[model samples]
Target chain A: MTGNFFYFLTFLTLFAAIGVVVSKNPVYSVLFMILTFFALTGHYILLNAQFLAAVNFIVYMGAIMVLFLFVIMFLNMREDTEQHKPVLSKIAAAIAGGILFVVMIAALKDVNTQMTTTAVFDSQIGMVENLGKVLFRDYLLPFELASVLFLAAMAGAVMLGKREPGEQNRF
Target chain B: MSSASNAYFTNVFIMNDIPEVIRTIPLNYYLYFSTALFCIGIIGVLTRRNAIIIFMCIELMLNSVNLLLTAFSSYRSDPNGQIFVFFIMAVAAAEVAVGLAIIVMIYRNVRSTDINILNKLKW
Candidate 1:
């Protein structure tokens, strides 16, 4: 039953992902991406990462996607304005993606599916309590650094988004 | 092996109580799933001219990697990878903030979201 559920979730995720890329309207694309994120959250749940699942929901679907939609609506571009990349470049992109996939598979071919003998695999690693301990104890520095990155990004975004009367043509 | 012993062996000893399905799924499956998703994002990024859609593709790519990392971390019994995944999410959030701000600024100035319109940096 769980295996069947896993396959079902995978199918949903892939379908939504393709919709995100293939949709003609930007609005539809954003909606599809939201669906993909939701499916990914379900995948996280299946992996027993409950904390990450919630984070995926809030940060991804709630904040980032809402921001994307705001920008899309704010831009208010026409629905018919579909810019097509040249046919040659489109083919090149697909080829490049396929080649990359093939290369990665080949490179990882030798590594097989023997269960890791490292510490026993714990589903509880996804629990907030366990993860909080590791995050604070072992990864304290990187965790703090992430906050600094957020500060810098926030400041930069504010600076960039600021409007000035005489700075019409300034980049 | 008796069914009871098999369950005990998988749960308490080998898996440390993770779901049986997750334990049974091959690592190769995770790799394939994530790589295919990542490649799709790559193609989207390459083909899409709209900056917002391009950024969405980037987020898609980031997510594929996130999924891969978490899958590996779970099966490898390494919690550090999950921590990294958290950080990646933070960085992604920051990226979306700054990226959208830039996009908004560009749209304000050029009145178009099309990349071709912004050929000159001096404008």
Candidate 2:
């Protein structure tokens, strides 16, 4: 029952991911990305990383996606605004991505057999208490550094997003 | 094709040992799925000319990496991998904020979101 749901979720996730890539309208792309993130959250829960699942939903879908949509609306990019890439680059990009995928798959094909299936785990690693313990005790420095990074990002965003003196809204 | 994936599908089901059930689904499945998604993101990045969509593709790539980390975290029973995932998420959030800000600033200056328009910096 769970396996079936996993496959189903995978299908939806992959499909929505493609939608995000293919949709011409920026708004649709943003909406499709929300769907993709939602599916990813489900995958996180399946992996038993429940805390990350909620964080994924709140951060990616709630905060990041909303910012994307706001930018799209603020910029006022109309429908049919997508530009046509040169024909050669379009074909080349597809070929390059396909080749990379094939090569990596061939290299990693033995991974499943190579992974030792011997050890069993608690499967509760996703619980917040365990995550907090590991993060605070061992990874505390990076955790704090991430906060500094967030501050820098916030400052940079405010600075860049600010309007110059005498600049119009352009809306 | 689809048959290959379907062949690996199992009937096992459990809510308690969800990890075991998920584990039994084979490590290759997660690895391949993430790889495929990552490649799709690459294609979008390479092919699309829209700045926001390209940014979205970068997010896709970040997500694919996150999925891979979580998969390995579970397969190895290492909370460290998940910890790394949090760092990646934090970095990704920071990246999007600054990246989209740049994209918006570019759009404001040029009145267009096409990546090609930023070629004024060409030497």
Model 1 TM-score is 0.90
Backbone clash pairs for candidate 1 read none
Model 2 chain A: ten consecutive residues of lowest lDDT: A112-121
B23-110 per-residue lDDT for model 2 (tens digits): 4466688888899899989999999989999999999999999999998787666799999998898999999999999998888888
**A1-171 per-residue lDDT for model 1 (tens digits):** 767787888889889988888887999999999999998998888888878898999999999999999888877865677677888998998899889989988877776655534445566888788889999999999989999999999999999998876775543
Q: Give per-residue CA lDDT, model 1, range B73-106, as digits (tens).
A: 7666667888889999999999999999999988
Off by over 4 Å in 2: A112-120, B1-20, B121-123
Global CA lDDT computed for model 1: 0.83
Tens digits of per-residue lDDT for model 2, A102-147: 9999989975433344244457887899999999999999999999
What's the TM-score of every candidate structure?
Answer: 0.90, 0.90
